[model samples]
Target: MTSFRVKSEGRFVAAGCALIALFALIGAPVIAQEANMLQAPAGMKPSGSVPESLKSDSSSATLAPADETGPRRIVPPGYGATTPSSGMPQAEEPAGPSQFFPAGKRASEPSVRMLSAVPGQDNSGIQIGTLTGVDASTAGLISEQQGGLGADMWQGASRADIDRYLSRLPVPVRSPVMNDLARRLLLTGAQPPEGASGGVSLLAIRLNRLIAAGQTQAALDLGAAAGNERSPAVAAGIARAALAQGDDRLACDALKDIPPGNDPAHDAMAAFSVKLSAYCQIAAGNTEIASLTLDLAREEGMDDALFYSLASEAAAGITLRAPEPNKLTIVDTAFYRLADRELPENAVEIVEPALLQSMLADPSVSDEMKVAAAERAAAYGLLDGRDLAAYYRKPSFTPEQMAGLLTSDIPESSSLRRAMIFQSIGMAAAADERIHLFKLAFATAESAGLYYPTVEALYPELDRMVPSDALRPLAPAAVRAFIAIGERSRAQDWLSLISSGGQMLGRDARELTGLMRVSGGSPQSFDSEKASAEIVSDLKSGVRATQLYAASEAMMLEALGFQLTPAVWDALLDARGALTGDVPPEALLNRLQASGQKNAIGETVLLSLDAIGQKGPGAVHPRASAQAVASLKAVNLESEARRLALEALMARSNAGRG
Candidate 1:
């Protein structure tokens, strides 16, 4: 009887174990099952010390200790719901462009927003040319027609009629528009009244006409004349005119006649004059006084956003305080905006980035104010694409603010600023977002005829981030950018990529690739004559702006890393139209040797051998100076090389010792 009982019990136990295993495999809620789910022998109690009902409730009700190792069931507030599989909620998506990826985006996407012609105003409708409605004769007629029927007719005339009658009104006229019309007319070449003595005021009007007529030199000469010499406004206007023409010396001299705090009766006019004086100071490299003059302008209530923003730029390395609201009145602010657009030379410097960032942070600043400040900063090179990216990195900003930055006025003619803004957008974007922005900046620059420096900023990141196929359209810009940044190998890499890509190359790209190939060759193999001719042709072609050609030549020369032979030097100088200058070769040499070129001192031993073959000991040839200096330094022959170079320079020039 006992043996039979044991066998039955073993079978029962085996069945119970199998049942638990089955529940585990099916992922059933067996742990939380009620007591009724299992049947116990009539006289047997549960195994756990606590009653099954109470124990089950206690396990579910009690919270886990902080350090306990188990699954955490409690989620803090706002963690809405967990995934059944993963048991953790997903992060919310960030707002803005990241949420929307435009489809079929080409490598060269177009973001054709106009750059502000004026620092803080619409570039449109602000004519630097002749006044639209009024000719010189009509202006004279308007000045002459002041008394009887004409005067009465003009008195009730609406602003539009005045505009219709006046021709090109230079600036917006405040009401009581006749005198304003009369002043503008006088300034636009209308003859002043016969008995009205042509003093400084009359000369001021004539100076304005001269400037309007594009006669900058004549206006400058007039300002220096006896009668006009004492007029601050005339001086300021002439200085402004001179600076616009790149005559910084003439501008500075003109400004000396109008000292800061030379307050005229009209505070607004005085403020305008003072701002011009500051620009002259900047052009003359008189940054200290420029800063002081800007301060005085603000103190006298010159709160034009352009003035302050530019003042901040000129005062780089100094912390500038923004003007009070009342000081920057709408009318005055509008005038400054007009001045910035009308006279870009006046505020050519960029506002400091840190100060601009502070302005962006201030809640009191209007979107328009921020936009104007940012645009001016960028146009003048105070801000860049990296700065733009920083602006976007913030957690919150209005769509209007983003739009304002993206569409801020850069001139269609300014490739540098356009390229810069485009690159800045790329710099601030995530890796996934960069490709489109980079291509857009490059494409826009090319479309607008701007071959720009900002391309250099995009080159190093191109290989990994940009696909091989998208590179063809970017070839010219890439070559130029790489060369400028002194990345000769990378520029070669671009050429290699394009050559191997099985795509047809553009003419400009082909030329650039050929140039790079020549540069990469041995010094003896370089065709200096042909290269110089090509450089001249490129300059004349104006594919890139003329001013940039010199820089390109400089880069090419540096990239070759060869000691320039006299023949080569002659060719380059001839191309530059600088061969006949009395300027010492030392100056040119100094410029070439400075940071960007980084020529490896041509093999020092080779230079010595050449010198030995050409000249006696210690007689370093003028053409060999570059290699001599670099090689000497490389082989610890620096002092001897220096001596040899100085001797050559002295032999080459009649320049007296400093």
Candidate 2:
């Protein structure tokens, strides 16, 4: 009985061991698949697990009484919070050796392996540094396509050199062509020169120069266009321009817009701002603030006696007999206007041309002073000819003055003479009488060196006169004036009248025709030999003045793309003896040529203007004129070149007549 029981227990134990082995064999593949899902592949770090802070606290868990809320859903660990299974297929597991190793089986080798080095890891061709300069050169009012010198206008030049050259440019450039060129260069939107960082900016210098040259409106427009109105220097210029134009409110507002602690680069600009602040404060009825501002200015080293006197007078409503200032600025002028003080007699002489427009509008100014200011302003292109014409129409003339205008003795004062003639031409009954009056007017203006201004003033009258055989006697003068003012169509009409007369061309008519051609008139053949011989014979005969003028005309013709014989150049050289002024240096000419060759448009224009100097083209040396024309043409400024040449010819003609 004992042996049978022992056998049964042993069998049971053996069966139990066999069952455990079967269960282990069945779970081996399932464990291997789970391990494959958890392990990261070669060359990749394992993704981070859920942070401890974000894990649920099982120890703090509590059971709440149930309500009618929706059923609580169960989510698996490490799932469903961020990435839920939508209906898309899961990514296939990385093909590699399984993390688990079954007994008696070696693990397969990993299909992916780590790389030794990454591609593009070399840094030999890379530059590592910080940029150190501020570039503000791209601010301008005009573009290259809008007649500006292009974005590359200052290439091949440094900021220091460009600033120096611009500083040396003549203010109120006398020649119209040079003036136009200077204005365009200053207003162009282009890149700044190299190393332009942290100083008085180029834009500020440009704005100051424009204001000094009586181009205040242009300076204001440029500052506005550049969106730099808040800069202290630019803001100061805008305020000054506003004062010059009698817009006190605008001036005050411009000053008010400047940010605090941003002082202007110029001491004069700082002083002007101080005075303006006081004046604006007074005008706004803040008397205490105005007085305090003035006190602060004095404490801060503003020593301008004129400004203090004017401000004191305005603030206290009392007049002070202050000594006259040696120089007057737009600020001083504004204060004077505010204080109701009569401007000094020499104000017209010392005042900048920019202030002349406001001066001309002042009713208290003498008629003579107004006329002088108008002439100077017109010459500088600050005022239109029609503006002077309006001033001329203000005075009334007696019937006798009008009747004897052509035959009577010319008035000694140029203003009265111009005014008299301007009036008489309007009332003249017959065309012949008007033509005589026109010739006298032009001759009088030419003698006084006011020919261009007179031409502008009388253009409407001349435009109304029909070109006919009867008016042929006045053709040369009419055509010359028309060409001087760029009225090419009118010049052509007068030139046709000269041709229609069917007479051999006289020296005056031939020369006038050549000038017309240079001013973009209809194309015509020129007789270079005849013109040169006439000038040469005149030179030999000691008619130096007339022939010198003729020589310049011939040179101008040749420079404007008209072919002239070598004899013409020889005659021009001989005629150079009559010129007594200093000629442009050879170095300047060389620089101009070099700039043109490099296509440095702004530099070329500046050097050309410097070569021309303060005098108009007519007064410059012919060599300078020739080189300027050539350089301008080389840079594709054909229109400017032609206009410059034409001006030279017209100046010579007018000078010869004088």
Candidate 3:
């Protein structure tokens, strides 16, 4: 929301041209204007003959000294000197064509005095390009003179009105191809007619591209002009653009123009910025940059979120291992302060997880800073599947302190704070196995007086933040192996390491033993002896008895000399849930007889079942059942095997007890 506000306010519209024209003409010495003049970057002077036709309609207006409280200068994308965003879009490309995930998020709005085309209330039908119904003559005139010039000219003609004039021209009429008349006139001495102050606004709309193109010196020179002569609004705008375009040094120069204010907007903005930048510099693999930036942002007022954004990103990058790629530094904070100076709102959310990511790694970020960072991240409300490298590195929240967040008079700020709390709750839930932990975390977040309505606050950022180090990094194969090998301790450990919110479905040894016994004792036809042996083999192999009937039914029938009842696996499954936790004693007895085994093995199955029932979840699970003992008689179709089975059970069970 803040970023969006910044982008929209950064470039003001001319609002019928009168407002800008009036501001520019209010106090100027009405020099007889000649042909329209072209703008040029500093050191590149323009000199050319004026067209005779242009001279015929020369115009001039009186202009005023700019008010100290005039509106702020707007910044275009890629304008900051400190923010180093690559061409990386915010999302991955595999899901479809190239597109950013968590789409349609707006840029941040600055709180500083807004430099706008006009009050938003002034007009309704205007297009960003032109005042909707202007006469063709005026359009043609502005169009013919306003089109075609790049980085250098833009820096000089950086005011919003110039951008507005640029917009009014139809694309075809505003061709960049300069004719001899136009080019020659620019070569001749032609100062762009003065703007609102009868003075050129140094910070231009085209500042970003110039910076991108490695024209840093030009930006600095323009900034110097603004610093020397413009109001805080224009100066700050230039500073923000330079900062965005990646030159903190120039940004520092711009910062000097920010007035001395007790409200601390400037101070906070500056302090919060470097505090984090220093930390992130180390985390994002640039200690020097982080340190230097940190030192500079420190000069910002404590209220500034830029400092915090840099700190959090630095800290989070180190802690969580994932850093946000599209980190817009302090562009929005500067504006937001001017928007509502007395009641300055926090500006941490504009360039999020980057702030979130960068801070996690910075060792210098103190505990108090973390609390500040977590609160801001939670408020931003991370989305599902969004990179959460920062949130994962350290606790996303602290339960202790939440001041005027909820109580703030501005409902919007309060609501945003609540949203942050809700997100923190979710993070807590993921970390602590209990839902209660999540609730507590969330409640603590809301206590800050922030508002949160839905889980929507913590968006599509799937459980990606649950880190490997934070949680046991168990692979699917590892989990499978643990399950197969009955490594319950290890399995549970892994499960706990991951988020607390998942289910497991592994069979218990005790449950299996009871199942075998219940099947063994059930009434079945034919000889019980062969049935007993088949049941034991199935149990050892972890196959259910019903399945045994499908393949082993033939062997059992022949051995029994008679057919038994239906396969027992199905009956076991049916009755299993009702039995001990899952296997009822009665159901087990029934399944026992259904196995078509003898009285001997039946005893072994029952004994094993009974033992497990007496002992509980912690008791040693019987490898063989009570009936297997009774089946001991059956097992020694050879006595040696019978003895071995009994010995193995006793040894294992006793060993378990010891």
Q: Which candidate is the best by TM-score?
A: 2
Q: Which of the predicted structures, 1 or 2, would earn the higher lDDT when compared with the native? A: 2
Q: Give the TM-score of candidate 1.
A: 0.29
Please provide, for model 3 over 336-448, each residue's C-alpha lDDT reduced to its tens digit, 9 standing for 90 to 100: 22222111113233342323323333454443344455544433322111222233333333343222323444243343344444444444444433233233323443344
**C-alpha RMSD (angstroms) for model 1:** 38.2
RMSD per candidate (Å) reads: 38.2, 35.3, 31.1
Model 1 per-residue lDDT at 373: 45
Ranking by TM-score: 2, 1, 3
Compared with the true structure, what per-residue lDDT tens digits does model 1 show for residues 277-332?
Answer: 45544433434544555554554555565455544454433222333233232222
Which sections of candidate 3 miss by over 4 Å? 1-235, 240-246, 252-363, 366-368, 377-389, 392-433, 449-658
Query: lDDT of each structure?
Result: 0.35, 0.60, 0.28
> For model 3, what is the error of residue 578's alpha carbon versus the real structure, in angstroms, after optimal superposition?
55
Better of 1 and 3 by lDDT: 1
* Native-referenced Cα lDDT, model 3: 0.28
